[model samples]
Target chain A: MSDSEDVLATAAAWRAAGEPVALATVVETWGSSPRPAGSRLAVSATGKLAGSVSGGCIEGAVADAAQQTMRTGSPQLLDFGISDERAWEVGLACGGKLKVFVEKLA
Target chain B: MTPALLAALQAAQAAKRPVALLTRLSDGEQCLWPDAALPGALAEAAEAALRDDAAANLTLDGEAWFVHPHNPPLRLIVVGAVHIAQALVPMAQTTGFAVTVVDPRRAWATADRFPGITLIHEWTDDAMRALAPDARTAVVTLTHDPKLDDPALDIALRSPCFYIGALGSRRTHAKRVARLAEMGHGEAAMARIRAPVGLDIAAVTAPEIALSILAEVVAARRGAALARRAAPAPAAAA
Candidate 1:
């Protein structure tokens, strides 16, 4: 199975175990995004992570957003561009732009 | 994401069925296409994305939605554990195909010979039938022996496998076709077999032959217009 499948399965397993979980998916990409649009990162309440939306560049931010989504029961659309200072601060200096949708698994 | 929806997606993937998950971005409402019976526009969008194995964001009725296509992993079932199989297995794996090598001869299909590979020490026909090659599956028979290769070709021709290749000389392929015909395979079914298999790249070595086969497999999968093989016959010795 591909890594995405493993991520989804991990997310499901965590949810089934009564752990709060959030899924962050790359909804769109521009230029040289490290991962494609469907790539996913599954984050659990206990700080466990499966898969990645980028090449270790912006996952920390996404995971942080995932935790926030889980706590607030709201979804978030995150946009990161190479030109954005916030993107650089998050280490997304990969010369690409990406939109990630983070939603708590209810 | 509802637990039910996530479980359904997992079930579809485990069953190797192609499905698309449609998400309403504005409200976080999600549904699996074909399962929930999407509207015409959404269905069309999902169909297109799934066909390309891509994910896209589209606005249907002025509402932004994400269509994520989930497809089964590609699989390759090789019906011979030969030297060429040795080369092709790793190449196919590198290309994201879960490969299985089948040969009844225990000596040839040993774990030592094919380390870390799925080895099926069964007759070709049985192994092919058990595998049940699907649209995402490719089957290649490398055993030049008719006893091994013919059974695989027969099973593969009847299946929905995306690609079926047989390694042999032109003369050998001709005989194989004749045998398949006598076994009730029609001309159209036989035509599906790319005999003297591989793109005609003038490949001479085993690894080169493996490369050509992998290239042709990718071409077939991507629906690329294949260049017809030039007449020197492939180096897959009969």
Candidate 2:
């Protein structure tokens, strides 16, 4: 199965098990982004995860955003790029920029 | 991201249907294209995204929408369990194809030769019937024997499979074409077969041949402008 399928399946399974779930999707990408648009990362309330938005460059930040989205039941559009202040820490090594949309599963 | 919508999306992917999830980034409002026919630019964008198996971000009426295309996994059906297949299978898998090897020769089609691949111990025509090659599927007949390759080609020609390649030299292909013609396949249909079954890379070894074949398959899938077949080597060169 493709990563997209696995991520969606994991998100669905987490929701079915009564654990709150948040889905993070790469909505836009520029330069040499690790993943393409629509690549997904699923985060569960219990900290389980599936798939990735970047090649381990910014999953931590996205996961934190996901948790916040779960708490607020609101979606967030996150922009990450080398120009950001946190670029040294969370920016992609390939120097790509991406926008991730995170939302809780209703 | 309602539970019902998620379930529906999963169901569509599981069924290997081409689907697009359109999300308006402003408010997380989502709808699946084809749930209802989309209008204007959004519809064209979704159609292109699905066709190219890529995602796109479009601004329609000044509202940003992301169209995420979930296309079915690419499938390859190799109608031979030969040496080139051994090399081609792994390469194709690495290139993201779910491959199946169909051959009745139990001795050649054993797991010892093609480990971890779906093996069908049946005639090529019967196997192709059951597989039902779709637009996402590619069919390659590596068996030199006409009995095996011809049947598969006949079936593939009638289906919507995107790629059909047969392994042979020019003379061998001419004979195969004549036979297929007798089998009622027209000239247009016969044109679809990529005989000599690879890019003209002067590949001699089995692995090299496999690489060339896989390259051609990729080219066909991407709708690349394939180079015209190179003429056979000059007789004086021999």
Candidate 3:
């Protein structure tokens, strides 16, 4: 299955199971970002995750933000760039920039 | 999540139809746009997105909407389970085409020869009818036998298949053309078949021939516009 389909299916399954779900989507990308725009990551309230917005470079941060979005019932936009020293710590060694939108699925 | 929207998306995916999911990122309002059946409410925006076959953010009436195009995988239908097919099947699959090898010769079209691929043990005409080639489908006839290749070419020529290739030499193709003409197909219709199949790469081996054929198919699919642009301009009037 495609990444979008996988994320959608996982989100639907979580919603059916009475767990709040939030979806993170890569809205924009620059340079050699591992994933392209429209890449997605689905996170459930219980910390379960499916799909990917990055090649493990920034998924942890996105998941944490997604879980927070699920709890707050609000959306958050995150921007990550390799220019930041912290990006190296997070493993974005490809020197690209990406923006992800995290929102609770209603 | 709206169950109706999800159901519609899944239905289109199951049918191998192209679809686009338009989402209003601000509020998570979503709608499904199946190809050629865009909702009247968002016809213009959806049409634009489908044309590009790419996901993009569109602002219509000052609302930001992201259009995610979900296209079905491309398909390749080989009309003969010959030696070339043994090499071609894996190459096409690796290039992301769902391939099916069709041949009535059960002895040749065995699972041992084409493991993990769809093998259709039916006549060329019957199999082509059942598998209905679409715009994203490529049809090739590797069998030199006219009885096998002609029927497959007849169906592919009439269909909207993007590429139609037939394996033969120039002299052999001339004979095949005469037969097709006798079958009532006009020159315009017969022109669709890529006679003497594959690019002129002097390919003699099975694998080399398969590579040339696939290269031609890919060029047909993605380089038509570029090929047109590269064509020499007509002589200027003196």
DockQ for the candidates, in order: 0.50, 0.54, 0.27
In candidate 1, which residue pairs get closer than 3 Å at backbone N, Cα or C atoms, i.e. clash?
none
Backbone clash numbers for all candidates listed? 0, 0, 1
lDDT by residue (tens digit), candidate 1, A52-101: 99999999999999999999999998999987888989987779999999
Give the per-residue lDDT digits (tens) of candidate 3, residues B1-238: 3667767877787786778787777777777775446445566666666666567777777877777777776799998999999999988887768899999999889999999989998889999999999888999998899999999888988899989889987678778888888888987787777867888788999999999888888888886542121222232321
Candidate 3 stretches greater than 4 Å from native: A1-106, B1-8, B34-43, B47-52, B199-208, B224-238
Tens-digit lDDT string for candidate 2 (A1-106): 5668878988888899999999999999899998889999999998998999999999999999999999999999999998876755875688899999999998
**Best model per TM-score:** 2
> Candidate 2 regions off by >4 Å?
B37-40, B81-100, B105-122, B129-134, B157-160, B167-220, B223-238
In terms of lDDT, the poorest run of 10 residues in model 2 chain B is: B229-238
What digit string (tens of lDDT, one per residue) describes model 1 on residues B1-238? 9878988999999887889999888878999977888889899989998888889899988999999998888999988899999999988887778889999989899898889999998888999999999888999999899999999889999899999999998788878878998999987787788878999989999999999999999999888888343344333544
True contacts kept of 1: 0.68
TM-score, model 2 to reference: 0.77
